[model samples]
Target: MERPNNVPLPGVSAARAAERATSLAAHLDARHRGQNAQALIRAAVKDLFRGRIALVSSFGADSAVLLHLVAQVDPTTPVIFVDTGQLFEETLQYRDQLVALLGLTDVRSVGPKTDRLARLDPENFLWQSNPDLCCRIRKVEPLAEAIGDFPAWISGRKRFQNAFRAELPVFEGDGARIKVNPLAEWTGKDVEAYRLEHGLPEHPLVKFGYLSIGCAPCTDRVKPGEDPRAGRWRGRAKTECGIHIAGSMTPENEGSGI
Candidate 1:
């Protein structure tokens, strides 16, 4: 009884695939602690380097760790920084310094489309009523469009930084591309150690307790032991501004002129 190669065997069911995905996710999450972070990222780089892989950086308080790693692997790899027209002056300056010191090449600054920004909110006043919309316009939408051609992108997200990121994996599938978090399992201390060891520069705001730096208007400084992202969109019932996700936005939430 010869069996066809492509078809499943007599009793193979869809459940097996679901189980495999779950198992694989769990295994990677569990195994991604400490030294495994670099090992897995190196492996991923090798596997994914057949095409373009951009490192999405904010040059924020904690991004130096991953940026240093990326520089070590391939300085020529594209590093995409979204300059949302509202970042701290220090942040922008830090970005330039780090890029120069790390010898990073292809560091492109992606921003909102010019005409859309003019049509949506000519004065950039949309941050008042619809912060989410402002974010989509200035950050998410532009970034999604910019990265449309790449199959995978690198990020500096760590699990300990936010509740929504508690279960972050080294690799996850975005709607259009894969998101690789090489530092997913790292903690604040780990980042500090890497920075110090490699002589990487930190964002100037970090010393002033701005743990999670985003747009200037939506972000603020935090006290010790507070959630790093506590000050972002402060007094508003928002955790993330949806800049990282693709197409999960609505006109009401992401386009309303608030």
Candidate 2:
């Protein structure tokens, strides 16, 4: 029997993937090493990938700093926001407010296809029984489809947020696309100081201890002394939604906010 047609296949071979990753990693190390986040984003938005790139943001607790920097670099840079249909209403409103406040002109809101959701999660309780599947259906598939046209995309993950991201690089390639992590070297204090310096508005739930807000069903409040991302998928070992996972790689701990 032939393979199912609806499934997505890996686009690059193992040999090609390793070669591309090595080449890109070397280039990024030389050019972006020790560079600040704003400069890195500027290069990604205007110099390197330019029109072929988009910034992926959750507009969660740690979002304002990155969004503000991107706006300053180019408000017209494509900003892709994924709405899982399970997000808090406050997140939707916050997205609106930030778009206007930052003068971001090209923000695109994408989500799961209706038919897929109806077929797979009609009851809307998939997270209770299967959170990984729920994340893939809601987040991974949608984000993958949303950015398929781009050669490079930006992510907002930071090293300080979790153990899985401790050694993240400024540029990562899985042979298919270049993933930029401008804030890989940033710490919690750096983010907070920048947020306060720019007077960026915090997500409403941040005050309620929801440090890393995502779809309301899978997110929870972080207790004091926990990592900022501790509130996300509290009971599960799964951290990523598969959007950031390369072929055969362990799932990335994308944190609650990314």
Candidate 3:
């Protein structure tokens, strides 16, 4: 087999990626168990950087914490942002502000293949009826395409986000990619403290009770003491839009509606 980095990288087959992802998951799991969660994440990131890995960001409400961590380690790591065309204006603004303040060197915004959307749902009503299919078209497929050439990518999914994420491992294999959720063990308070201490730019909607901000149409504000993610896809049977793994996001008997 060709050396990992020397092969023709872009558009690697799903099968090949799965193989590497499994190996990466094993190595990370073994090495990180004895270390504290934050230390483990930082160590994993440093290993990726030494091997020239790509770091992905959504630049959402919780994204600042991860971005801040990446900036401390390596400012030049390629940071890919998936612009689903449905994000709030505040998210876009925050993305720019954080990149500049953190001195991120290679930030790129990616979107879905143009014709795919036109063919799938010309009226854009797919989100209203079948949000999973809509998100697959808009977010997942494009992201799968964007990260095809990378061995690893980072995410900010904290375990406290929902029941689906409560037992999240420090490292895991997500089909064709090594999905690294660094802050997997962090609570809500941890995120707030990081932002305050670092003096990071906040997403404008955060103050309006919008905790888990996603596409504009699918998000809303939550009431006090409510689940931060309770506002998304309000009144609909959708906890997550299938961006995260299916089993990892299955809603409880409480029904899927946000």
Candidate 4:
């Protein structure tokens, strides 16, 4: 099973994409077990995943923390933003403002194919009747197609964001990619402190009690003392956009990679 140094590793190649996602996820989890978000970002962008890594951001409330960290580590790193075509105007504007301020060179805006939308959701009210399907076409599918080529990708999810996210790990495999969550341990206070300390721009909607901004139709303003993500998919059983959930990130079976 041992290969010589002259022989190139199969799964590590760019063409192979995420063939080594499981192994790399385990290694990164072990290597950066006790590191902070900044440290994890450095390893992901400059060392471990390097050219094969990307950071996905929603430009939602507290997103500035992870974006700022990734920008500092490597502004040229591919920043994948899933534009579900249902995003709020404020979120769109915030994405632009933050990218300009951060001087990120490779911020890519990806969305569902127009024809796909035309065929599946011409009425545009699918979110009301079938949120899961709407999310699949508008958010999950688009995001998967965007990040699928990368061996690894970073997410801004944190444990304190909601009940389901309370057990999130810093590193885990999502079938096709090693999904890194550098801010998994970050609290709301930690996010705010990082934003203020680094002078990062906040999402415009954050001040309006929209603590967890998402699509315009699904998101609502959060009440005081409620979870930051409580307003998302308000009055619905769905807590996630289906992108992360559909990926089936089983940190439990993987034994908590981080």
Candidate 5:
């Protein structure tokens, strides 16, 4: 029998959940396609997802633009930050500064389980041998847990940031949840203008040529006329840390060394 659109499916399988999420994402993308970044964020945070959504931020370079928009909408909105335990000290301090300046009330910092780290990466050199696995334990897993209760989440990705994200949509499905990229259509000029207009502080590393900041070990300084994200995972084919990709989020017990 065909289920009605308004009817709820109880105990649906993972496949079914993903299908539903995809459908929801399409609808949302179409509905809010013409809205500006601020308007779109307001809708996602206040109207559409409301209490069931969160914003996952790296608190990296150019993060303040999106964070400022979200703050204007609701300073108390849940913001999930994954502390990979390998980030630059400047990044940590920048996170704190932004939270206080924006008056954000619910900023949660999550990291890998101590037991898992001790067993799988006691030497903390997993990033050297297996960057993907290191990200799985430090970023992907922790973020998955942080946003598990939410049906939707916001990302700070912008199309102008990198070629991989150049065609990013304002709304998309990630596993069983809807991922919103309010600034997907925004350009680099847009971000800089907004930041300066609002007097948003820049990440300290940006001045040192670290345009695309990540962990201290993996990130490097971008040379003149290079891609902003060229500094990430330098000399390696790896671009992302595995958090933004689909199917990267695994079950909590899948790789937990416990």
Candidate 6:
């Protein structure tokens, strides 16, 4: 019998899956490092993962550049957007604007389960008391569920975003799946240049200095001289939203938030 398209290889133990992701990440990183972003995305979407991969976009700040590149390569590629219930209204509108402008197909907007929210956070104050748990329910868990069937996924993280991401690789192993960062080598200037060169629309909030937009409650405007992601979860030690953390697919192991 033949395996179904886009489904993970069957019966592979978790350990085996992890090993495969590691090997694949190393291979892809070596082969595509320093290449153009479009070429990397093209290969991932059209040649390598093909039907088994998806793009996870936040549609904030410099997202339009990556979305435009992916649309150029293949507009029908699956795009996953985690609509944390607390996101800025501007972010949602920007998502819609970019989707229509880029002609993206298959944009999946996954959110935290309503039943889980009612049970764990009836008052929706989890972010004030336990941000890690809030992110687990709102961002990581939903994304994990959204990408459950994909063997690989793309992210828009770049090295210049912050110190924590200064050494981001072009590819990485996220538990059993391969995570590709086509823009890992791009700088803030590079992103802006691409957006201008391609005439992509900017995220509406960028003009107001919300360099790293996330959920409304946590995101803030950046100062004149700060890391692009500094405004995210301001005054908190949390640097990530737990979605990018290894083993984050499991709620119990959810790390920090971005």
Off by over 4 Å in 5: 1-10, 250-258
Report the poorest 10 consecutive residues by lDDT, candidate 6: 1-10
- Whole-model lDDT per candidate: 0.72, 0.80, 0.73, 0.78, 0.85, 0.85
RMSD in Å for candidate 1, one decimal? 6.7
Evaluate residue 20 in candidate 2 and report its C-alpha lDDT on the 0 to 100 scale: 64
Mind giving the per-residue lDDT tens digits that candidate 4 earns over 75-97? 99999998999999999999999
Q: What TM-score does each of the candidates earn?
A: 0.82, 0.88, 0.84, 0.87, 0.93, 0.92
Strongest candidate by TM-score: 5
Q: Rank the candidates by TM-score, best first.
A: 5, 6, 2, 4, 3, 1
Higher-TM-score candidate of 2 and 6 = 6
lDDT of 1 by residue, 1-258 (tens): 121111113464434432443454444445544546566666546553334578888899998888888777778878888899988999999998998888997898988878878987798888887787788788887676666556567888889887878977776645434567788888888889988988888789988889999999999889777788988888988888685553342222333333
| TM-score, model 6 to reference | 0.92
Candidate 6, which segments miss by more than 4 Å at Cα? 1-11, 250-258
Q: Is candidate 2 or candidate 6 better by lDDT?
A: 6
Q: List the residue pairs that clash in candidate 1.
A: 129-258, 133-254
Which parts of model 1 have CA positions greater than 4 angstroms off?
A: 1-35, 246-258
1 against 5, candidate with superior TM-score: 5
Tens digits of per-residue lDDT for model 2, 71-159 = 99999999999999999999999999999999999998989888878988999998888887788778876777777657678899999
Clashing pairs in 5: none
C-alpha RMSD for every candidate: 6.7, 7.0, 6.0, 6.1, 3.5, 3.4
User: Over the full model, what C-alpha lDDT does candidate 2 score relative to the true structure?
Assistant: 0.80
lDDT of 3 by residue, 20-137 (tens): 6667677777766767545655665565434546677778778888888878877877788888888899999999999999999889788877787787768878788788777777
Query: In candidate 4, where is summed lDDT lowest over 10 consecutive residues?
Result: 249-258
